[model samples]
Target: MNKDSLNTDYLWFLIIKSLIMKNVDLIFNEKQESTLFGYVMKETENKDKIWFWVTIAMTFFIMLLFALPTIIIDPYFHYHEPLTDYGYTFYRQRYSNDGIVRHFDYDAYIVGTSMTENFKASEASEIFGYNFIKVPYSGGYYKELDHLIKRSFSSDNDIKMVIRCLDYTLLARDKDAEHEEKDTLHPQFKAPEYMVNANPFDDIKYVLNKTILFNETYSTYLNIRNEVPTTNFDSYSNWCSAFTFGRETVLGEYTHTDDVQPEKEFTQDDYEMIKGNVEQNVIATINEHPDTTFYLFFSPYSICYWDTAHSNGTVKWNIEAERTAIELLLECPNAKLYSFTNDFDLTCNLDNYKDQVHYGEWVNSDILVRMKNGENMLTKENYKEYLDEIEEFYSNYDYSTFAVGNEEQ
Candidate 1:
């Protein structure tokens, strides 16, 4: 309880503090000096070596985890055994179409935008007496169409007929011009220079992508279980009437309705651009392939579309462009022109279309039947008359009935 007792206590406290400081310094110094210390530490050279191998093994395992599905499912159709049944549900058409062209022994190709998607390959084969494959791009432009047709013709198999649905919008641009920024063709279809160059290393993009990996995995599972649908028609079998009003529809489900109207207009300059595109892409391709029979049909967009065209002031120019296109095709001995655009009963009937532009599959099938039967084949003789009739029909037709809120009236 004196000054000497207080000094003794202070000395004991200093000694304990010194020991605690020393321990703290050791821990801090070890952390600062060691490369791997906090969670995983390698104090000895042997431990360092073990850690390095472990890291390498872990990386290799991760890489394999990503790469195995790419190899097994082979979504790109890059490798695997014959009859492996590569499913098409999740397959990207721009990439898959090349493989289909290269591997499938089809003589004829049905190539176009989504309008051609519903055209049955089986019916075409049966009627045309050639093996058929439908290569459709949902919103394809002429450039995409040209690339697909060129690829089909360049294949090893015997090149027969090519049935193409001419999309009028595609003709709005110059054939050689690139797509507009807002409407660019899918990257899968755009350049394909990677595929052409056969760059194996670039495939790492596909192999590592989570989306591609999941789709390929799902597709492989479907294939293994034999639950995969036939890829011949692609997703067309799922397409139904799309006019179900407010009802939700999946692929293959469409509806029939008589209520629709046009809301677009066109100009003289638009016609000029369309003409140039048709000349550069369509006519050029037809002229290039003299030996191949080209059956080109203008898509039967519904009357609502024509109303929009008329509203846009593009109706007359549109007819003129068609006449020009038909004349050009007729010049080519092997090219057959079919003018379904003038089929009023088919085009005017709202029941035949899922939208302003997309017609039902039955319309597509009937076109094929007519083509096979040689009916409605547009010759130089009938071409003028057909255009006249179409013009008159458009002039006389009243679009007020299709007004958005006039269904009851």
Candidate 2:
């Protein structure tokens, strides 16, 4: 065909297709209008009474079939056990309980990743004469820690003490793009939407579906219910087991499986930065509530993993961190290091660790004992001893055979 003739034909085809699409839309609209008119006429003839009742019945049926099951079944299938537990409480409160609002008057808080979850607030309260709450959210790093400290310490509730079981990697300041991309991933870590300073739009998905999606709302309720009940020390250990193994089986998600070894000491500048944060943020937080007495700790791990970290140059960082942490406490005049790591015999047990770093609730009970006996209650002699042990641990296990601020042999 000639080029001019082919161009004309294509133009004609485009015009024809546009007209056909318009005609099809017009026909569909007309059919919809006719169907609506018929329904309206029928309803008018019946005085609209029958139609109203039928509509109500259908609506109720749909809610019962769809909404109820979404509130109940979907979370179980999704392996959101925590969500299920919260939903269960919410339903019970909404339907059955007297509907009392849960209030916060906590005197103590247990803060950390899953490693800290086993410590029961009640036990801490009983031991320390302070009411305790576990703000246990796994994957919470230093940024989250800063937020929680600011929010909780500043609240009306007089927080008497903060027992922090910090993960060692929290010192890593390499920020990921996910920190901005996935804000909705951790609501507990973020400031509340209603707060003027916090941008609610940051967690758009949570505000939308977490609030509007009625099914997911039920899961939140279950999470609240699960939190109220205090599991025994043994139950806490079993829960750790579930967290370690059951999570993989149920959700096919890994938690705290990463192996880390500290290989190099942070420079004096880095050491100062970390120390400054712990002092300004962590220690200053306790000081905000004059009534509160802080006891800081580093949780115990297996000797093998501990040794590996020590060999990897973790010992120097750990010592510097702890030393700075102590200096910050000294500034407080009332604060102390409840030194579980300083006194424990890590060489005795491989059974202590569930993995590279975390362990079960057995340590929680031991901690309670240590706190009670004042074994962890720091003295100058004991403080010197703790520093000595760090050096000894490094000398014995450190593979690089290097010292902080010293050249390799």
Candidate 3:
């Protein structure tokens, strides 16, 4: 061996020694041998434990941020105390109806489609001697009304009167017919069962929804400022005006430039079925609550509606159904049947209507006044006379002259 060979041997020995020391460091300590397999194992376990705790902390923080406030300050669940009176503009009626009936302090309920929305609850309350809450569901069917009536009766609130504005189109629909598609009622008009049962899923849905959250926040601001949406009818303040037009403008808008056919014909059986459902649902509801005063009135649609009905050959059927409904309702001692359908002075004037079917709130206010005054009511003795007059007016009305212009008219 030479000096060069000795140097190479020493270099190899140093390298080998360094490798051995590095391997020794990977071994577990004698005391830690039972707990940890090696240094890498211990480090990996520690990292996983830290990650698990961090993830848990993040989840709890998220829950606190979103879930906690929504649960505690539930705006949709009206039963929860310190409720923010967000008004009907932001109000999700499907979720809030039962809650309002259950929690709000009101004695009379104004039930109907959008027509009744214009009927001032304050005015009705004054005349009927009851505190009133307007629960108008747009395009509501009799079944919807029945559900509301039952819920109103079921609630702890003192429900003395139910002022229902009956829409003739709804009366003509089948008993099982829903206002919405798929035979499913809108969430705003669903039965109180889910709400009454305190469904947590429903609560969470409204809580986390972006639209609902926005509305709630906006409503809170409105409530704080005691402000109402421009479109809203303030029953407390007697502000019932709902349209932008003066009487002249409304009439001009509805004045048709051409004759149009907007009516659909129904078979005799269909008419009968509609009448039967009305009796079964409406009349039965009236009879059920003898202690409650039921003011059922036909909402006055425009003359165009009647013209369409007559042209479609369904006017007679509609009249027959109306007659039957009136007769049945008259039988119920608790019911008072009013008819605004033949109010030619109002219905004939196109200016009074926003559309063919929807009249302004002034007409609604007039109807409420008439109901309180016992005017325009169709009793069994005079319903025939009223119906005959309506039929005659519908028959003689020159729909062709009025229909020649606007398709909407």
Q: After superposition, which runs of candidate 3 have C-alpha atoms over 4 Å from their true positions?
A: 1-65, 81-92, 181-201, 217-268, 405-409
Per-model TM-score versus the true fold: 0.71, 0.58, 0.72
Q: Which stretch of 10 consecutive residues in model 2 shows the poorest summed lDDT?
A: 92-101
Give candidate 1 misplaced runs (Cα > 4 Å). Answer: 1-65, 78-82, 85-91, 177-201, 226-230, 234-238, 241-272
Please rank every candidate by TM-score, starting with the best: 3, 1, 2
What is residue 47's positional error in candidate 3, in angstroms? 13
Whole-model alpha-carbon lDDT for candidate 2? 0.50
| lDDT of candidates 1 onward, in order | 0.66, 0.50, 0.65
User: Which digits, one per residue and each the tens of the lDDT, describe model 2 over residues 1-409?
Assistant: 5786566446544654565455443332323545543445444667366557655765565444434434343322221223324333222111111111112345667666666767776677777776676654455555555455566654567566777765555543432101222224234444233221234344233333333234344434445646654222223323465544221231222222224454676577766677766655566666666666666666665444455565455667666666656655656655666666644464324346555566667677678768667776656656777777866764465333222232223
- In candidate 1, what are the lDDT values of residues 228-251, reduced to their tens digit? 754555344336454442112111
Tens-place lDDT digits, model 3, residues 1-409? 6786566446544654565455443342423634333434555647666556655765665444444434554554455533444433433455556556666677887877777767777777777788887776666678876776777776777678888887778777777765562212344544434554446666545555444443453355445467653222234222236455433454455544343444444567865877777877688888887888888898888876776676666677677777767776788888889988777888887777766777777787788788888999888788889999987888678776455344344
lDDT of 3: 0.65
